[model samples]
Target: MNADIKNKIIKYSKEIGIDKIGFASADPFVTMKERLRVQQENGFQSGFEKGTLEERTKPDLLLPQAKTVISIALAYPSKMKNAPRSVKGDRRGIFCRASWGEDYHHVLRRKLNLLEEFITNMYPEERCRSMVDTGELSDRAAAERAGIGWSGKNCAVITPEFGSYVYLGEMITTLSMEEDTPIEDQCGTCNKCVDACPTGALVQGGQLDATKCIAFLTQTKTMLPERYRKKLGNRLYGCDTCQTVCPENKGIDEHRHPEMEPDPEIVKPSLEPLLTISNKEFKNKYGKISGSWRGKKPIQRNALIALAVFKEETSLPSIIKVMNEDPRPVMRGTAVWALKEIAPTAETKHLLQSFKTKEEAPEVLEEVEKALADLSSQGGMYV
Candidate 1:
């Protein structure tokens, strides 16, 4: 690799809004393939609908002529207070802090595309393709190889400068360049991430069981299983319990990157307001939110689920509306599950009883009776 060429590209990359950039020789990552094989064998990414062995192993999927991968990481701005300590309107709510702002995918994609254009301009004979977690490229492996960061046990890429809050972007190229040294894995004996998980999804050895994973349960387009509800705590979207406890995520203000601006609505949308919104309205309020793309049902579903976890019975009116109004029986089922978790009051008891006589959806009715059963066990107390 020419030193002058590498220096010029690196300089241009940083100038194009990427905090850090590095190169890795483009070859089928045999080790990553092997790990992926094991993960598939052991069912690591099993919950993912489109994620498959062939889906992950296709080398040409990332770059048709991939000779080298030019990877960059952008630090997401974050604060400890961003994670919710309570379900009150003041608390931001318990979800991943990274999802709080503008979609990192959009922010990082523009930067990667600019860098790709700049690189292509310099090397007219070569080609570059911008990839932002859209292909088979092993990003964590790429991040590790590029010295951008090492993957934490929670599977988040952690940088010394930005901890684990960096969003990764890649520019696959045919240009051969000098690669950076991979960083050493720093997480040793500390298991704060595992200990802090509300669900025991982090079973062991960097394996994540999506069935028990709160983030997975919330974001997945399918139905959430019954057992994971209370374990979800007040998390309405993705869960960030593991990252918050990691030791490496120290120093919130000093080395923090200043470019990221999280959208205010995602920072903290009110629980009461969520029930009244339709999908069209949801698109208007949350279309830009990372959580919004999944559609209003999941967000509304999780909001009711969270209200139940908080046991804030005062949210019952709105919760009851969502329980009855949501067209998706799956969401309504989860809403009833949330109501049960919140501790049923007399009005809620009557509502549950009323749903029993008139509820048509079998899934919704299954849980409606379960809610009454739950209330009976809890001594009919209003939480």
Candidate 2:
């Protein structure tokens, strides 16, 4: 019966499309506590610091009776016809594959539920609960402890078969299963992920400052500080620079999941679409998407910043017009900055005259004033 339960889980998990599953005793991962302590001191986690997160990383906190953890990984296909992740003449934009789909939270949690049900049917005496990255538990650490994969310096787990593009989840339960030994670190002398980061946020070993992390900034609601905007390139939602440069990811057989394909508009999206996405269309296009979870204003602002970096003079007219209409000052401020950098045409000069008089935020006004000065220097009227 014990062997049958184990085999049933492996068999069923494969059938459900997961790449790997492993079990580990739910003993407190002593190493994880130290890692979490160090990471907390770094203060880089930012918005990820809140939620049921604190308790979930600690096995005992989630389920006092928990005696086992089952770790699961699902691979996001690496094949991109657009060649965006590569750095050749193509210069692929980096996007970590994990987030490319329907939130793995729904995808893996449903699987975890089925696995739990399968376990309980075998032993009705046990209790079980499952979670994806949502659980307070350190899903990465559990994956390492369960021998699912080694934790790479990029802070992603990499198995030989899936490379580093796998998503992780956990099932904490009262029933103990035979545990697997953790994989050895294979990222020997590899600094590609660290060096590839446009921001110096990955300055130290496995630690990262998510505040400076482009992935976090793309999704954040507040205006991004100027220091990091230069590094974001065109990414509006997430960044995958480190993962793309990982040597381990090379020669990977691309795995495709139709569950999360890039909506062409969002992928390499034009500044025009961002500046004009209405609230209704924003909800319809991004309601289930992680990028639009914070709404369109932040993303639109990011798009404007991206345009500024590219010096895209063509988008000037539409962006300059919206600088006055966007309700969020941050969005307006971003438009002001982008237009000043990229547009500053005769029409823009006319609008900034009105903008200069009515704008209220001090920082935004400062940016507006600077943009006006820059435009004036180029012989565009700024009065």
Candidate 3:
């Protein structure tokens, strides 16, 4: 009966657009519990993680009588075709592959919901609980246990077919099923992902320092530390450097779902107009994408940093406008730094001096002072 049910579910999953599906015993994630404790101790947790370790690792805690975990993966496109160029004057910032297209959370949740309905229709007495990225359970751990993929050195579940460019979701069910064999780690002796990390966020083979990770740092709402600003490059949201450099990911680009297809202009948006985008305009443009979860503040701040990276002289006016008028002090401070870096001049100093008296926020004022000092050292007037 278990084998028959598992076979039926796998067939239904493909019909419902699930790229890969696997089943595993719904036992506590013993190894993962230790890893999570160590991650918390070492301050490597991304803080975006959901639930306590116990609740996350114990399937029965999430759903009583849980006997099997069904893991699902949907491959996403890694490369953007006909992507708009980031040229001079009209520089652009990128949203990472995970944020390209409609949010994966929505996409995966829909798949999970369909799978849950299928299971319930077959076994009416079997209880089931489903969750996507924001769920209490660790999706990667479940995926690994279900033989969906091996956990890569970059900390992503790397499927043989889909590589690492996949969104994961899971369902805990009361029905028991024959479990598949776990995939062996195929990332032997390769250190490309670690070496490729701009921030050295990958502490070792499978561990990551969330504080230093460019991906986590980009999503932060507060002012970014000076040390990580330059490392950001032209990224407006998330960081795919580690995945991009992985050997397993070589030539692995999937475009299965139409909703998952990226709009080149939206994913790589112009930096200047982002500085002045009204809240409603930002929502209208980016609300559907996963990158917009933190709202527009962080994206706009990163845009300023990206503009500075390109030394976009034409965007100086937009930078100055944001610095002088934007209500968010973080945005204003970022603009101040970008203005000096992109087009430092006598006028830049004059603008900094004028804003100094009016800037009441201590953090913004500190940024203003730092930019002033940086400008002065570079031959701009100190006063």
Candidate 4:
């Protein structure tokens, strides 16, 4: 019965547009528990993790009488058609590939809900609980255990079919099922991802220091640390440096799902106009995409840094406006830093010095003083 039901579920998953599906016993994730403990102790967690260690690793804790776990993967396009260029005077900032489409949480949840409905219809007395990324159970761990993919050294699940560009979701079920074999690690001795990491966030092959990671850094609502500012490049949301450099992902660009296709302008938007984008405008434009989860502040702040990275002289006025008029202290402080990088001119120094008198926020005032000192040391070149 378990085998027959597993086969039926797999077929139904394919019919529902699931790219890959695998089944596993609802056993506690022993190895993952230890690794997560170490990660917590070392402060390597990104602070976005949802649940306690026990709940995260044990399926039964989440679903009482759980006997099987089902993992599903969906492939998203890696390449954009008609991707817009980021030229000087019209510089742009990027959201990573994972954030290119409608939020995967919504997309995956819909599929999981369908699967749950199918299961309950087949077994009236059985129960199920489904979760995407936000769930207590680790999606990657469940995926790995279910033979959906191997856990790559880059901390991504790398499938032979989809590389590492697949989105994962899982269901814990009361119905017993035969488990699939877990995939063996295929990242042997390849350190390309670690070597190419912008901020050395991939401490070694498999370990990541989330605090130093540009992807995590970009999502923070507070002021970006000076050390990682330049490292951010033009990325406004998540960073895909490690994934891009992986040999496994080199020539793989899936276009299986239309909803996952990127709108080039939305994912890679002009940096200048973002500085003053109203809240309503921002939501209407970017509300559906996963990158907008933190709202427009982080994206706008990253845009400021990105403009500075490019030394976009054309965006100087906008940056100055943000420094002077933006109500958010973080935005004002970031704009001051952007001014220091983009135009450390006599005019900029004068502007900073004058603003310093009226800036009440300690953080923004500190940025103003730093900009003034840096400009003074540079002899304040005229723009």
TM-score of each: 0.89, 0.89, 0.98, 0.98
Global lDDT of model 4: 0.92
Where does the lowest 10-residue lDDT sum fall in candidate 2?
86-95
Provide the overall lDDT of each model, using Cα atoms, as 2-decimal numbers: 0.71, 0.74, 0.92, 0.92
lDDT of 1 by residue, 1-383 (tens): 57788898888876766788877777666666787777667775645434455545454565676677778988776663444344454323444566656666787888887887887887889888766765556677777877888777887888888788778877778787877788988888778888787878787646677667777778765566777767766576787778777888876432244435654445566666776677688777666657665677666667676666667677766666767777778877877877766655776787788777877998888888777877777772542
What ranges in model 2 sit over 4 Å off? Answer: 1-4, 51-54, 82-96, 344-354, 372-383
lDDT of 3 by residue, 234-328 (tens): 99999999999998899999999999999998999988898888889999999999999999889989999999999989888778888888988
What local lDDT does model 3 show for residue 128?
91
State which candidate, 2 or 4, has the greater TM-score: 4
Give the count of colliding residue pairs in each prediction.
1, 7, 0, 0
Error of 3 at 321 (Å): 0.8
* Sliding window of 10 residues with minimal summed lDDT for model 1: 83-92
User: Any idea how many clashes model 1 has?
Assistant: 1
Score candidate 2 by TM-score against the native: 0.89
For model 3, what is the error of residue 164's alpha carbon versus the real structure, in angstroms, after optimal superposition?
Answer: 0.3
The digit string of per-residue lDDT tens for model 2 on 1-383 reads: 65566788889888877779998888877787777677667776766654443474567678878888999988776654553332222222233455555766777777788888888887899998787875578888899998888988787788888788787898899887777888999888988898888887786667778778888887777768877877888777777788888989987745546675654434444455667878998787666655566677777777788777777666666676778777778888888877766755777666777788988888778777777677778872543
